[model samples]
Structures are given as C-alpha cells and as structure tokens.
Target: MKKLGITLLVATLFVSCSLSKVEKSARKTVDGNWQLNSVTYDEKGVFNTHLLNDVTATCFENSQWFFRSNNSTGTYNILDSDCSTGVRNFRWAANEIGKDSGVFDFTLKFTDDKKKDIEKNTGYRMNLKYLDDNHMQITQTIQFEGKPFNINMNFTRTTL
Candidate 1:
C-alpha cells in the first residue's frame, strides 16, 4: 500500500510539470521585443476584422510587442495616431499538441497592467504556425461563409 501511494504521488507531480518540449523551446525563442509587420489573410482579398477582440485589424500593423518567457506575460503597443494608441497587456501560453511535434496550441488572455483577467472565461486561441529566433507567425482560423478563413499575424524580432 505504501509503494502504491508513492507511485501515485510521483505520477501526479510529473503530470503537473505542464510545459512540453515544444512549448519550452517556443517560449525561449519568443522572449524579446517584436514588431507586428503585417496582418494578412491566406486568401488574397481585403477583409475587415478585429484582432484579439480589440481594435480594428489595421491597428495591429507595425505595433510593438514584448514577451517575457519567464512569466508568460507580454504587452503590445498600438502606435498608429489615427487608431487607439496605448499598451495592451496579455498572458499567453504555447502548449504543445503532441510530443515534440513542433506544433502548438497558442492561447492569449487579455489582462490589466496588474495582471488581472479582463474577462471571465473569455480568451482567444490560435495556432503557433511558425517560430524562430527572428520571426514568428500565428494564425487564427474562423468560419467565414461557412468556410475556414485564416488570419495570419506576422512578427519580426526587434531590438529595444
């Protein structure tokens, strides 16, 4: 009976570690500042949309972003004078879908500066399509006209 109890405890602890191989790799590579170079759709056409349930899609272009892998928290600044000009804080995670698969289930939860959740039970999930030291791409697929439409947000690492 004693051995069984110890075995169960060990199993629980192993499962609770949580971070997968890909997630750890992604977090390390994503730590730093980045510039949102563009927002594009997989299909060639103009479509109006909002990103991360916030401002218009156009507002994300050329925005500055910062990610802290240590705490999984980040901030983005919308610099367009014509649009909302402010910093938005968010908590994010890169969850690996399979064992060392290089694919991740990315989730973002908007928060206040104090790191309090802005909305209860509400957040966004996207796919971490690609990531490297200098570049990263995230895609959110939504239903448009009963078909899947992909919204891609591209980012490039920046200094300072």
Candidate 2:
C-alpha cells in the first residue's frame, strides 16, 4: 500500500509539472507576427486552397497578425489587393477552457482607437494549435448557407 501511494503521488506531480510547461510554451510560441500561408475548408469534403482562391482569403493576403506578450495587445494589418490597407487593434490571450485539458481557447477582441470595444458583445474565439516555434494553425467553425463549415488557417512567423 505504501509503494502504491508513493507511485500515485509521483505520477500526479509529473502530470502537473508537464501541464504548466505546456502552458508557458504556448504563451511564448504565439507571441509574434504571423502571416497567412495556406487555408483549407471542409463543408462536404476537404478543399485545399490558398489565400487568393477566395474573396475572403484574398482580402487576407499580405495580412499580418501581431501578438504581444507584454500587454496581451495586438494588431491585425489587412493589406487587401483591391481595398485600402487598414489596421485593427485587438486584445488577445492564450487560455484553457477546462481544467488540465490541453485544448487552447484563443480569443481576440477588437477595440477602437480609444480602447473602447468595437465588437460590443461579440469577439473572435478559435482553437489554436502550435505546429512548431514558427508555425501555428487556427481552426474555426461557421454556419454558411445553413450548413456547418470548418475552416483551417495555417500561418508562418514573419519578420516584419
């Protein structure tokens, strides 16, 4: 009984330590500028596409999402080919929705120049996954034409 109790305690400690390490790594890995590289969608089937394949993606071309670690504030710079360039300031955070779960609840809130909420009660929330130090993926599900559509966006770290 003593050996079993000791083993359980060691296992619990190991798991707790591991989770904290992952949380810290996630916070660091997402702090930087990320440029959209590719996009994929699944409605009826998987469709591999690029940023220029669709109107929405095209507008996102040359766009950069900046995530700051200091104040958890960032900016989304949109450089549309046929539209004027604009910047949207926002607050971002890496959060977990459930206890001891590895799932990441990435959230963003767009704010105006005065730091007032522009989105009011709505904000962007998505599942964030880090592929590596310089690559990350964001997944979002939306209802389009009364059907559910899953969109996956892949981004690579940019130096600018």
Candidate 3:
C-alpha cells in the first residue's frame, strides 16, 4: 500500500511538471504583436452583438494587440474612428487542457496599466481554438435563446 501511494505521488508530480512546460511553450508562441483581423460567428444571419460585454463585435475588427508572455500581460487598442479608441490592458493565461493537445483554455481579465485587475469579479474565458506562427483564433461561447452561440475572433501576427 505504501509503495502504491508513493507511485501515485510521483506520477502526479510528473504530470504537473509536464503541464507547466506545455503551457510555457504555448505562451511563447503567443508572445508578440497581433492584429484582430475579423470577427465571425458559427451561425448565420445579421446578429448584432457586443463582445466581452464591453464593445460591439464590429469595434474589435482591426484592433492592435501586444502580448508579453514572460509577464502574462497584454494590451489592445481599438483603432476604428467610429468606436471608442484607447488602450485596454489585461492579463492573460494559456493553459493546456491536455498534454500536447494543442488546445488551450485561454483567459483574459481587464486590468490597469499597472497590471492591477480592474474587473474584480469578472473575466473572459475562451477557447484557443487554433494557433500558429502567423494565424490564431479564439472562440467565446455564449448562450442565445437557450442555445450555444460561438463568437470566433481571428488574429494574425504582425510587427511594430
């Protein structure tokens, strides 16, 4: 019984370390500047909606983003003349759901420039659906009329 207990402990430790490494590698890939190229949905039709409970979906298009994986912090700016333009800071994390699964539970929280959390009890959780050196996608699912609605935010890596 003691040997079995020790074996389980060792296994758990190994998994924990492995997951940490996986998450770090994924975050490294996301470090840099990106552009929110477009916003799409899973279903069809003209559905006007707000994203992140703060801005309309159209307002996010072409937004500029900067990420610092080393510190788990980032900022995005809305550039459209028709929308409010400013820098919004946030802390983000990419957590691998499985070993080498390439799927992650990405989370973002609003913060101040000093990295202090601004939304004390609210944050956004989304799926890191796809990621690569040049392109990435995040999906946020919300309920609409008692059904799941997916909001897909596509991004492209950029410089400057």
Candidate 4:
C-alpha cells in the first residue's frame, strides 16, 4: 500500500511539471510574415461579414505584413489591384496594460515615392485577439463620418 501511494504521487508530479512546461512554450510570437485573410465591419451594433467581396476590398486583397522580432518594426505592403502599389513602414509595440490585456500600438507612414514627402501619419491602437501559431485577429474601433465603426481584421501566418 505504501509503495502504491508513493508511485501515484510521483506520477502526478511528473504530469504537472510537463503540463507547465507545455503551457510556457505554447506562447506564440508575432514575428513573421502574415497575410490579410479577411475583415469584418461593425456599424451601429450591426455586424457585417464577407467584407472581402466589396470593391474596396481589392485594395487589401494582396496586403502583406512583415513583423520583425528584433526591433518590433514592420512593413505593410499594399498590393492594390486597381490602385497603385504602395508600402507603409510601421513600428509596432505590444502593450499589456492589464493582467489579461493584449493591445498593439502601430504608427504607420507612407514610404512610397509620391507620399514619402508627405507629412501625413496614421496610427492605431488595436486589440490583438485569438493569436496562435497560424492565425491572429485584430480589432480596432474608430470614428468615421461621425459614426463609430469597429473593424476586425484576420490574418494568417505565411512564413515560419
């Protein structure tokens, strides 16, 4: 009976230790190339899906975002089908203001020849959600035309 008790305790301890290790290693990093897969828009509490079918979605169809782990800098390539191709240089930082909060702050500036001389700068504070090895979603709320709009963009990892 004594041997059986000792063996059971050892087994439990082993299992617990392995689980903790797995949990720690399962955290995913945002370093890699990610492609924009889809987006959803919420207006006045109404949710609209299948936003990629619209004509404006063509501008973002071939969009790609590359994030670097070393310096937290990235580039967004906008390969618009109908419009001119452009690239935006951005610096991103993850913010954990709360215990369970995961937010991303991005500052974007045009790097193309035409807009390179322009002083227009865009920034966004978005919440990072459902981030895993292959998939991630970002949500942002903005005011457009005197109305509140919530946009959710989904991405898929394209590089290792």
Model 2: lDDT of residue 5: 100
RMSD per candidate (Å) reads 1.9, 8.1, 3.9, 12.2
Task: List the candidate 1 regions with Cα displacement exceeding 4 Å.
Answer: 1-11
Predicted structure with the largest lDDT when compared to the true one: 1
TM-score of each: 0.92, 0.72, 0.87, 0.60
Q: Using alpha carbons, what is the TM-score of model 2?
A: 0.72
lDDT string, candidate 2, 1-160, tens digits: 9999999999999887553655667877888889977666755564533322224665665678888876778887777758556787888777765765767887778788666777688787777865578888887766667987767778899998
lDDT of 1 by residue, 1-160 (tens): 9999999999999988868766788999999999999999999888999988888889999999999999999999999999989999999998888788889888999999999999979999999999999999999999999999999999999998
Better of 2 and 3 by TM-score: 3
Residue 121 alpha-carbon offset, candidate 3, angstroms? 1.5
* lDDT to native, each model: 0.92, 0.73, 0.91, 0.60
What lDDT score goes with residue 122 in model 1? 96
Per-residue lDDT, model 1, residue 98, is 75
Among all candidates shown, the one with the greatest TM-score: 1
Tens digits of per-residue lDDT for model 4, 1-160 = 9999999999999885542322232223667899988776765555433232223444666589887656556776777757556666666655543334343432333334333423455455676655788887777667677987767778898963
Model 2: lDDT equals: 0.73
Clash number for each model = 0, 0, 0, 0
Ranking by TM-score: 1, 3, 2, 4
